[model samples]
Target chain A: MDISFTSLLWGFLLIIIPTYFLHHYRTGLVKDTLIAALRMTAQLFLIGFYLKYMFDLNLWWLNVLWVIIMAGVASQTIIKRTNLSLRQMFVPITIALICSVAIIDIYFMGLIVRQDNLFETRYFIPISGMILGNMLSANVIAMNTYYGVLRRERTNYLFRLANGASAHEARSPFMRDALIKSFNPTIASMAVMGLIALPGTMTGQILGGSDPDVAIKYQIMLMISIFASSLISVLLTLALTHHKIFNKYEMPI
Target chain B: MIQFNNTYFIYDEKPLISGFSVNIARGEKVVIYGPSGSGKSTLVHAILGFVQAEQGEIIVNNLPISPDSINEIRQLTSWLPQDISLPYNSVRDMILAPFEFKANHSRKPSDQEILAEFDKLKLEHNLLEKGITEISGGQKQRILLLTTVLLRKPILLLDEPTSALDAQSVDLVINYLKSLTDTTIIAISHDEKFINAFDRKLLIGQF
Candidate 1:
């Protein structure tokens, strides 16, 4: 809300790319700088448009539907990033996101704050969008680690498979890696909260005239939701990706 | 027992080994000797299901193997790969890797068994505490051998298990491998000394 639409849009377009290469981070510097600026603008503009219309309508079914769509798109990105098969990824990941997101949302809306309408536009839309965004990021990290570790330790995984380990056993190392990688940032962020940095959500709350204590409470709830969502999503992705990547014989290359 | 029927392997659509057919019965210690680029490593890798073959059938223990069944075949076979990269946890973890699988999970050998194998390779008891990154190439090869042996697979596929060893180390490895002849040992190497008293030789040519 604090970020104006024109500033956000034009500012991104006006992004100046550094032409000369720096010492260490010079790999694709100009292209990356330009592309990143463009991508950020386009992505944020698209989200802004979508959010405007979505909030205007404010229907519960539409909100729920959007969340599902966001989840699907996020899953697709995850699949593409990891180069994993998509045959059976839909069910496990969707189920994980729904369960984890709903748990925290229900507690925040129903029990703690007890908002007037459980499906109100003001509360449901922003929180849900935030949850979806967090979920997407967490899953990317998780799925990335899972796929990377599996590839790097291919021999070890094959060795496990040969030793009569099931598909789960073969993928245990990757699963552990995925879960750890996915959850690490959130854990670190929480650990350093209010000391090293103030999170965006809490800052936004303070700017909106909310008390610091209230903002802190909201931030706490969000951390829990992000953590929970990340954990469940990572676990689900790891388990399902194992099945999708491996054949009936547990071969992963 | 293993059978390679007209196996043809290609990488980037370029044939490495073509029309290569061979067979090995149980407890037969056969050596595959070839020039550097003759696809000897490729053939060994193919049998392990690591390298995909363009055309041909490979049957191990009477089961036809595709790229997928590499895991199944690997369970029943021990491997000392030509590239001896043991980049995992500690040296102990590297050595005990075979026992961590379902096929050999129940057979996590006692300390005495591990110590015996280590002693046989003239390794020290303290080597178990060291990390894989800290081990020498020869030591890593010995760990790989012990790890592969712990699998107790019927077929043992070795790729230059002694190519880098000193004469004494080579002698030790060869004798230990010789004693484990209950396995169908098909070793790929160009070392004339190792193959001097070998049971049989399959000389490979440029593909």
Candidate 2:
């Protein structure tokens, strides 16, 4: 957590060699590398400043506000991906994002992790960020799959509906396909967990001088919580936002 | 039976079909002919519950149609739109799309039945496994037409089914549609040959 000038200098130096090599390996990666580097530095610096104040206060409302902000940003990103106008999607997107992140944060911090203090910024903030990250990805896939598949296979979906299929039934195959693609990484990572390697969360704990057993226990709990939260968030977003995305007659927005 | 009781539909406040009342009897073959922008496609879509009439009761089989009843009405009709939006699947797969519904899943025709149907359409059995994305428009029309017929619905709404085809395919389609034993046929066409084959025509424009 130290942010000395030496640390900053070393970070820049570390990136120089890798960025230079990437530029050589892929001639087109120069712009992409520069953008990513700039984004990372700006985002991390802002986050560090924000966290310094939030952790200094360590108030529950401040922690919750930050989580909401993150969720709102994630939902906005999802909205930007679709064909629908941004103004039309605000209500549904916000509902899905807030409901998802709040429920996930509560479950992760309150029930599973069981912090000594409910407002512990260290425990709540990092966990909420991780959960939001997973939820963001799942929602994007759900959005892409739900609308993209409808556009691509309009006839099939129409035929199904015309054949007395409800929206849920008509869209089941595409939804299933999209969910599979989105969740494949997490599912695979779970299967290869202990056998392949230690997860980053557990490694972080061990690096910070916690007992291996304690880190292992925390990792198991977090993984389970993440899996459950992700399932509910993805399912809820797909279900709730669908009504708004379609007109009463099931026309695309 | 389908009856439009003074159906008034407007798209973006521009009236498409206003006070349009039309009754299509069961087992009737009716062709809808008009120029572009004549609301032919819109009418067809309204029948299938794809579009909502602004102010009218569309009665089907003696009941005022609600959104809940749309499924039942749709079950009794087959539609082949002017544009085919078949996905990246095989021709055989596309033909079998309708029957994948649970209502029709159990009733998929046997191989012999399918072959017999394909034979009537002059479709080669080898094309069964061919990719749908690779098929010609003519082939797509024929297959889609065949699939609709297989639904065993009493009504058919064809939107320019022959517009993109050669003379032979048009002849085949017109003949097939005309010769069907007992089905209510609604075809939207401007072709002279297609018009000559129809028993009754509703010319939307110049009336």
Each candidate's fnat, in order? 0.28, 0.40
lDDT of 1 by residue, B1-207 (tens): 788899888766677777989888889999998788788877776676666667889898887886566666766776776773544779777766657666677878887888889998999899889887777888888778777787777888888888778888888888888898588888887677888758888988842
Tell me the deviation in Å of residue B159 in model 1: 1.7
lDDT of the structure predicted as candidate 2: 0.78
- How much lDDT does each candidate structure score? 0.75, 0.78
TM-score between candidate 1 and the true structure: 0.80
Once model 1 is optimally superposed onto the true structure by TM-score, how far is the C-alpha of residue A144 displaced, in angstroms? 3.5
Provide the DockQ value for model 2: 0.41
TM-score of each: 0.80, 0.83
Docking band of candidate 1: acceptable
How do the residues A60-143 of candidate 2 rate in per-residue lDDT, one tens digit apiece? 888888888887787787778665556766667767777876776676667777776766898888887877777777777777
Clashing pairs in 2: none
Second chain alone, TM-score for each candidate? 0.89, 0.92
